[model samples]
Target: MNAESSVGAQPTASAPKRFALPSPARRALLRAGLTGAAAVGVSTALGAASASATPTTTSRNRPGTPDEALRELAVGNRRWRTFRQRHPHESPAVRQSLTSGQEPFAVVLGCIDSRVPPELVFDQGLGDLMTVRSAGEVLDEAVLGSVAYGVLELDIPLVMVLGHQSCGAVKAAVAADESGESLPAHIQYIADRIAPNIDRTKEGDARVDATIDANVRAVRAALAAEPDLAAKIATGELAVVGARYELSDQRVHRLA
Candidate 1:
C-alpha cells in the first residue's frame, strides 16, 4: 500500500476503544525496556495519552498515537504467545472496505526471517500494520523512504524494528566476518551494512544473538534520526522502538 497516493476516501471514524493499560504498568514497561522514550526524547514531546491502549477490531479501530500503537502491538504479541489470537480484520468486509482507502496504525521494519513475519508475529491482519522487511533489519534508501512515507504521508504513529532470537542473516554475517570470507552477490550488501554494528568478539550463538539485537537498535536509531520522521516524533505524533522476538518461547521482548 502506497501512503503517497493522493486519490482515495480517507475515513475519519474516531479510533475505537481499546484495552487500556494503567499508568503504573506503563512505567514498568518503560523500566523493563519494552519501549524507549520519543523512545530517546520520546517521553517529553508526547501529548497526554500515557497508557498502552490496544485495538481489538478492523481498520476502523485505528490506534491514533504512539502509546496506542505500541499497546495494540503488545496485545497482539501477547495473544500470539498465549495462543489466543483474535485474528482481527481478515474478513471480506474488512478487505473490501480497505479497497477504497487505508489508514494503518504502525510501520514495522523487521527481518525477512520466515518465522518473524510481522503480521503473524504481531497477530495483526491486513490494513492494520504497514510492513517492510530486509535481512537483519538492514536499512537503505528505499527502506528508509518506505518508512518515511508511512510516518510523513499516512501520519502513522509508530515504527518498530523487530529482530528475533537466532536470526539467520546475522548468523551468516557473523560467519562471513569470522572466516574472512565474502558473501556472494547482493548478500554481501546485507553483510556490509551489518558489519559495522556486529559484535564480533562474542563467539558461537552469542555473537549472532548480540548482532541481531544490535542491528535492530541500529535500524531503530536510523529511523528515529531521519529528518522528516524526527519532526513528527517531536510533536509526539510518532515513535520508533526496537524489540527482540524469542522464537523458543514465542514471546516478543521490547528493547531499551
Candidate 2:
C-alpha cells in the first residue's frame, strides 16, 4: 500500500508480462543440446579410427622383410582356402595409392594354368605381388629378366615358384617324351623345358605329378643361383621357396 501511494496518481499498469521456461524444461533442453554435440564428437572419433584401420599400399607401410611378406601371403591363402578371403587392396583408394609407385613384397613365378592364377590363389590384390607365368612354370630369358627386375631393382624379398597339381603342361611334356612325338614349334619349346623335369621311371599321372614338383624345385634353385639373387640370399635379404597348389583342395603346400 505504501508503494502504491508513492507511484504517480494515475494507476501504474502492471510490469510488462514475462514468460520463462520451467527449471526442469530448461534442463531438458540443455541436456538435449549436449547429447547432440557428444554424438557429433563420437562420430568424428570413429571416422578417424576407421581411417587408421584401413590398410594403405605405400612403400613405407609395405612388409619390411621376406618373412613378413611370406606371412601375409600365408594368411591370405588361409583365407582363400577357408572361403573367407578379404580381397584386400582392390578398392579405388588402393588403386590411386599405387599411382605414384609400387612396392611388391613377393615375386610369384607360377604356371600359366588358368585355375592357378597367383593373385586369386594368394588372395592378394593389385600392387602386392610381381607375378610371372609360363607353361609348367618354365623360365625363359624374358621371364628370368622380369623376375630379376623384381628382385634386383624392385627389391622384392620373396620369390615363390608355384606349381599346381594335374598340370596340363606337365602331362603334355610327359606324353611328348613317351611317344617321341614332336609338338608344334612353340609348343615344343615349352615341352622341351618341362620334359627334363619328368621322372621317366614314374608312369601315367605319377610321372606328371613328379614333373610338376620337380619343375617348381628346379626353378627355385635356378632363381636362387642367379648372381644378383644369390647375393641377396647369402645376405638373408631374399628367399626362394617352392610351393604347390592343389586344385582339388584349394590349398598351397610349401615344397621347400
Candidate 3:
C-alpha cells in the first residue's frame, strides 16, 4: 500500500500539505547542495558507494515527506501487530538495486532491546530505513553522527527516536539512581545519560516507564535542536519524532 493509504490513523487537516513530495528539481538540488556541504561526513558514512543507487522508480520509491514516512511507519507497525506484514522490499531485485547504494527514507534511533527491533516492529525491509541502536536509545557522538548522515546525505524525511515499554536501560538508570550505586564502565555511561531524564520522585516500574517516555522526548528534542538536522526541520524537509514500542501488545505508539 502507498503511504497515503497506509495511514490507519486519521490524518490532520493540514497534513496533506505536509505530505507533499519535493519537486524533482528541488529534490535533485537538495541532494546536490546538501550532499556537498556534508561531503566529508557522507563520504565517511559511505566509503565505497557512489551516492544513492536508489532510482526514483517502482515501489521501492521511498516516502518523500516526513508525514508520509511517519504514516508508512504507522501502517507497517499496524501490519506487525496484526500479523499481517507484507514484508516489502525483500525481493532479489530490490536487494540488487541497493547494491549500488542506499537512500533510506527514515532514520530510526531505537533501543538495543531484543524485543523491539525497529525493522520488524515497523515491518520495513532492506534499505527502507537507516536503523541506529543504543541502550535507552541514548545518543553518543557516533550514534548522533550516524543519524545525521541519513538526514543530511540521504535527505531522509523523518527521524524517529524509538523508546520502548519496560526499557531495561532506563530501568537500570532508575535503579542505580535510587540505590545510589554506580553502574560499571560503559553501563555506567548509559545509566548516567539516562538518569537525568528520569524523575527521582517516583518509584518502581511506573518510574522506569515514565523515564522511558522522558528519554524518548529528550532525545527527540535534542535531535531536533541539532544544527544540521534543525536546518532541515526549518525548511520543512524533515521531522524528528518520539515513539514507544509496547512489548506486551507488540505495538508502537507515537509519543505525544
Candidate 4:
C-alpha cells in the first residue's frame, strides 16, 4: 500500500504560465520541473534515499499464511534492492472490490521510522499488511489495542515486531538508564518498560543494533505474555515473530 497516499494529493502553487511557450510543450516542461522539484523536496525533507532511482515500495492484498507473508516481503525486498519493482496494481476495480471489505495478511508492530516502512520493506501491495508503529516499537495500551484489532477483527495470523539498527528511541532509553536522568513523564514510562530488557542485554556493548535486536525479542515475549494474546497463541491461532532491519544491506533478519 502507498502509505503516503493516505495524505492524497494536494494542489501546489501553479507554475507560472508560459506565455510564449506552446501549451503542450509548456505543460510537459512544467511537469518535468515539478518532478525534479519533488525529488529535491523529498530528499531534503526525508533523506538521501528518497532521491534514489529505487521505486517506492507498496503492497497489494494481504498474504494468506505467515510463511507466505514472509515470502511476499522477501520478494519485495529483492525487487527493492535490485531496483526491479513491479508496477503497482491499484485500479478502479481493486479499489471498488476492497471498498466493502479488507482482509490484510499480516500485522506488523514496527518503529515509526520512515526508512523502515513495513509495506515497502516487504514489497506488499495495498491492503496486504496491517501495520502499527511507535518509537522503539514500544508497547502501550493503545498500541496493544491496534494489534488486537488486526488479530481479532482483521484475523491476521502473523504479527511481526520489526526493529532496526541505529534506532534513536532505543538509544535514548539506554542512555537515560545509564545516566540516571529522569525522562519525561510519558517517556519515563517507556524507558522503564524497556530498561529491563536493556539490563538483560550484554555488557560493554558498543553497537545500538544489538539493542534493537534484543528489543524486538523482548517485545515479542512481552506480547506473548499478555493474557489477551497468550490464549490465541495456545490455540495456534496466532504467531508473533521478531525481526531486525539492517540499514546498510536493506534486509530483515527474523529473530523469532
Candidate 5:
C-alpha cells in the first residue's frame, strides 16, 4: 500500500535498471565466440601436425643418392675395421620407426658363407641393405630377379657383388676341376657355377683368391647386363660394383 501511494512520485531508481541483451542475442554472441575459438584451435593443431610430419619424412627417406649410400658403407666399414662399430639403427626406436616403411639404399650380393654376412661386413644395421646370397655370389635367374626387384622397385642405387677370401665354394670347384671328381646333388650346381671362373685362374696358392675375385666380377657383370638393371645403369641411376671381404683383417677392399 505504501508503494502504491507513490504512483505520482518517481519509483526508486532501482539501480538504474541495468540493461540486458535479449536471449537470442546472447546465444548468438556465445556461438560467435565459440566459433572463433574453434578456428584458432584447428589452425594451431594443423601447424603442429605439419611441424611433426616433416622430420619423419626426412628421417625415413635418408641416404637418397648412390654416392651417399656408398659413402655410408665406406664409413661404416671403417668403423668395423677399427672395431668401433656404432651398430646404428637397431634400437627400439629405430625398429618402431621402420615399422612404417623401409628405404634401403644398396643391394648386396654376397656369399652364403656364415663368416661373411654383408650387414656385418659393411657395418650396417637393419633396413640398410637388400642382401641376396648364394654360393660364391653366383647369379642365376632367381638371384637376378631379386637384384632386379631391389633396383627397379625399391629404387636401390647400388649393387655390390661381395666375395671373400678362401671361399669354400670356389675351392670345391677347383678341387672338382683338378681331380675330375663330381660334386654330388645340388652341391654340384654350386660347383658348376663356380667351375668356369676358377678355370680362368692359374693353379697356385692364390688360385682360390683369384677365382673369388673373378667370380665377383662375373656376377657384377651379369647384374649389369640384366635388362632391368641395365636400363638403370645406362641412365646413371645405378652402379654395379665388386668388392672383397678379407677374412684376415676384417676389411673390405673394392675390386677393380
Candidate 6:
C-alpha cells in the first residue's frame, strides 16, 4: 500500500462515482434562512446567499476577498509550522450550525497525502474550508465540477493547489519515467498524471523536489485552464495559487 491507499485504494478503474448531497433537514433550514434574509438589502442578501447555500461535497467557509483568504491560510500555516495550532472549535454548536449549512472561506484542491491535510495545515476548524484531495493533485471532470461548486455555488474566493515535499507519488513518477519500470495500474495512473510535468522540468538534472514543484505547477495550470475557474479568476471573484509544503519546516511556500 502506498501513501494514497489510505484515501481509498487508488480509485479502481471501476471505482464508483462519488456524489454529495446536503441533508434534507439542513437544506430545509438553509432555505428558510435564505428566505428570511433575502428581505434585507442587496449586500445583506449577498451575504446570506453564501451562508444559506446548499451544502455540497465542495462546501466553503465564508465569503472573503482573495487576499484576505490567502492571508488567513498563510497565518494558519504559520501556527502549524510553529506547533501552535489554534485547535479551534469542533463543538456541538459548530456541528449543529453547519447542520444548517456552511460558508468556507477557501477551496483547497490538494494531494491525498496524509501529512498534508488542509484543515490541520491551515489550522481551520470544522466547516472552515472546502477541501478536495486526489493523488498527485490530478484533475478530471468530477474534480473540476467540485472546484466549480466552490467558486460558483459557495462563493469561495481562493482556490489553492497544495503540493508537498517528499511526495511519494512524485518520486514514483520520476522513477518510472527514468527507469521505464512497469508500475501497477493504480500507481501508473498517478505516474502518468505527473510524468509530463516532470519531463518538462528536467534537463537531465531532475530531482524529486524539482518533479514535485513541476507537479504543483502542472496542477495549478490545470486549475487555471478550467473554464469555470478561468471565468471566476478573470472576473476577480477567485484566485488559484500553487503551494508546496516543506515537511521539515512544516511551512508552505507560495509558488510564484
Best by lDDT: 3
Q: In terms of TM-score, which candidate is strongest?
A: 3
Instruction: Write one digit per residue (lDDT tens) for candidate 2, span 36-139.
Output: 56556757876321111123446446776767877778788888989998788888877667644567888999988999998988899888889999998888
Q: Count the backbone clashes (under 3 Å) in each candidate.
A: 6, 0, 0, 10, 0, 8
- Per-residue accuracy of model 6 over 87-160 as CA lDDT, tens digit each: 77487776666645677888898889999999999899987788999888877666866776667667788888
For candidate 5, give the lDDT: 0.70
- Whole-model lDDT, candidate 6? 0.71
Global Cα RMSD, each model: 16.0, 32.1, 7.7, 17.2, 31.3, 11.4
Clashing pairs in 1: 36-39, 37-40, 37-42, 38-41, 38-42, 38-43
Q: 4 or 6, which is superior by TM-score?
A: 6
- lDDT tens readout by residue for model 1, 63-181: 89888888788889889989998898889887666644567898999888899888987899978888999998888867876676566556788888888988888888888988999
- Candidate 4: C-alpha lDDT: 0.66
lDDT of 5 by residue, 76-174 (tens): 888888899887789988766654456788899999999998788778887788899998887776777667656665678888888999899999888
Ranking by lDDT: 3, 2, 1, 6, 5, 4
Model 4 deviation from the true structure expressed as Cα RMSD, one decimal place = 17.2
Error of 3 at 159 (Å): 0.2
lDDT of each: 0.72, 0.73, 0.77, 0.66, 0.70, 0.71
* TM-scores for every predicted model: 0.76, 0.76, 0.79, 0.70, 0.75, 0.74
Q: Model 4, 1-256: lDDT tens per residue?
A: 1122111111131211111222446545554564567668867887632222121233344465655666666677777666677634466765545533466778889999889998787766666678999988988767876686566555677788889888878888888878899887787877776666674445545535567776777777666665545566666667677777777888776763
**Backbone collision tally, model 3:** 0
Q: Candidate 5: which stretches are off by over 4 Å?
A: 1-61, 199-201
Selected candidate, larger lDDT, 5 vs 6: 6
lDDT at 232 for candidate 6?
Answer: 73
Q: After superposition, how far is residue 147 of candidate 3 from its true place, in Å?
A: 0.5
